[model samples]
Target: MTPEGKALLNIVILGLGFMVMFTAFGTCGNIEQTVIKSFNSTQFHGSGYTSMAIIYAVFSASNLIAPSVIAVIGPQLSLFFGGLVYSAYIAVFIHPYTWSFYTLSVLLGIAAAVLWTAQGNLLTINSKDSTIGRNSGIFWALMQFSLFFGNLYIYLAWHGKTHITDKDRQTVFITLTVISLVGSFLFFLIQKPDPEPAPSDASESLLPTDISDSSSVVASQGLGSQALDAFKKSIQLAMTKEMLLLSIPFAYSGVELTFYSGVYGTCLGAMSKFGGDAKGLIGLSGILIGVGEIIGGGVFGILDKCNRFGRNPVVFLGMITHFVAFYLIFLNVASDAPVAPEEGTQMQAYMQPSVLVALICSFLLGLGDSCFNTQLISIVGFLFREDSAPAFAVFKFVQSITAAVAFFYSNYLLLQWQLLIMVLMGFWGTVTFFVVEWTAMSTRKNSDYASI
Candidate 1:
């Protein structure tokens, strides 16, 4: 196969691997808070929220060292290792204990830092400026597709049951663990692009360059020094003005991610008056979220390939979509629905809960999330082409930190308050994102005119 073919193949393989792996992890994750709550032990009280918070917290801190680690082991191996860790994390669900749960959360966090940084680096290496947007959309679309299958299984398993049993949880998780293992194995099959593109001359490359090309840097330095340099480089790049500003949307994505992935479902599951199995409804909601994400990702991916799409427009659309979703959530769901499931307590929503409206909000939230994430990936991948490992590390760092904060507060904050924070973050995040994007465009245009 040609180098381009190889690159495309690698991206597809990564996407497939993630889709399967996350099918297990993400499905289980969607029900985590609810399941932990089901434990009915004071020791595991609030464990779901706390565990996820722990994962992201460790994830955020580990991102600082991810670049250095990747430099030593290479991204593909890093990915393989991360996948195994994820599978292990999922397996623990079968017989979960408090110590094992929290310990694995920490391990999963570290693994996430490596996995995502590797993913970003590999994606950047496999793409040119023209294809980055499309590739990111394609990859993300594939990955998010997990939400559909995983949740469908949940819907089938828990469908008519008034309460989930330990047996049901075990059966579901066992199936998930096996699925996760299959996905993790696919990482080992990923072959680097054959006849890899030679490192571009930094001065001639259109994007700002950094010292992250492992092949070029590691050949000349000891492993220890190379690791230190990569770490330092990531820190320096993160401190750049453009990156600092971009952190706003990155953090916003985290908050929104927390909502869509965990809190939204929790809210729905808490309300039993919706005239159907609550777990089933949550599953259906996940399916819709997947549908919305796939539509946005497919549309944007195709349009960007034809040069009919732009990042700013998509970002604007995402913000608007999210505003609509948040508004709907505020109106339809109870303000206290997400805190915990109270015994014999009636749901006190702002308005009567409509199943249709809740599902619509879920779809919109997913679509908006894809818009922000695809654009964010394209932007960082394009602007930091040479330093993608560290750039992505910083991106994940900011995102995970915010996700941790959101998860930590999920147990305390009213749904309305959380939605309000999301709105404020969405607005400021977009404004700041526009500033950097516009500046980059202006700079590029000037460079083009100078060349002419």
Candidate 2:
């Protein structure tokens, strides 16, 4: 096979691997709060929210050190070990316990840190300057399929049930654990790309330098010093003017991600109006969300390859779509629905809950999220081409911190307030993103003029 064919094949493999893993993990995550609530309503009241909060919190801290760890271990091994840790976290659900649940959440967070950073590194290594957007689109589109299939399983398994039974829980989680393991092992199947020859002219190169050099450099350092240096570089990059401005949207992505992935479905399950079919609706909502994401990723990916498509339009699409979804959620779902199941159904701020409106909201939220993320990935890939690992780490760090904060507040805040916050962040994030884009464009134009 040609090297280009091999690269394309590897990108597909990586996407498929993630698709399988997240099918299990993402399905489980969508229902996590509700399932945890089922464990013992009195004691585990908001433990689902709390567990998610913990995962992101640890994930946030681990990003600082994850790049160095990836440098030491290499992206492939990091992926394998990370997948194992994710599977372990899913297994904890099979025989649910508070201590084990929180403990595994912590481990999963650290694993997530390494897993995602390795993914970014690998993706960057495999892509050329022109192909980054196309590759990212393909990867994202494939991964989003997990949501559709996983939720289809849920919709089939628990469709008519008022509540999930112990037998039901055991059966579902066990299957999910197996799926996650299979996905993890698939990472082993990915053939590592041969290291690139050194660039003769660093000043003119558009692609990143090979990660092989960084790996050798880290290999020579003590582990502690490597970690400290990685952390320092990440902090420095994050403090730069462009990254600082970019962090606003990055943080907003985190907030919106939590809402669509976990909180939205939980709200659906909590409302009394849905009753016996709430679980079914949760599954359905996930299916629609996945559908929207697939459409967005596939569409944007294709358009991006066409050379005429611009990033700003996608950003605006996401902003408008999210605003619409948030407003619909505000109207159709109860304000208190996200707080906890028992106390959630007392009030609806506007229209009564309809299954149709709920599903629509889910679809829009998913589509909007895809827009924000694909653009962010493209932006980061463009701006930080030479420093992919730490750049992605800082991006994840800011994103996870905001996700943690959103989860923390999801416990205490009403649905209305949460949507309001999303609105504010969405607006601010969009504006700041434009600022950075304009600045980059201006700099590029100036450089071109100077050369002339």
lDDT to native, each model? 0.83, 0.82
Candidate 2 structure quality by residue, lDDT tens digits, 1-452: 87677777778888899999999999999987777766643433237788889999999999988887876677788888999999999998887777888999899899999998878877776776667777788888899999999999999988877777778888989999999999998888777565445655543322123333344454566666766766777888888999999999999999998998899998988787877788778889999999988888888764563334346778888999999999989989987788766323756558877999999988999899888888788778767777777899999999999999999999899888999999999999999998887776677653321211
Poorly placed runs, candidate 1 (over 4 Å): 40-46, 195-199, 202-219, 305-309, 342-345, 446-452
Candidate 2 accuracy as lDDT: 0.82
Worst 10 residues of 1 by lDDT: 204-213
TM-score of each candidate structure, all chains considered together: 0.93, 0.92
Q: Kindly give the number of clashing pairs for every candidate.
A: 1, 0
Clashes of 1: 1
- lDDT string for model 1 (176-247, tens) is 989988998888777756533465464332112221234655556677887787798899999999999999
Model 2, position 375, has a per-residue lDDT of: 77
Report each candidate's C-alpha RMSD, comma-separated, in the order given.
Answer: 3.4, 3.5
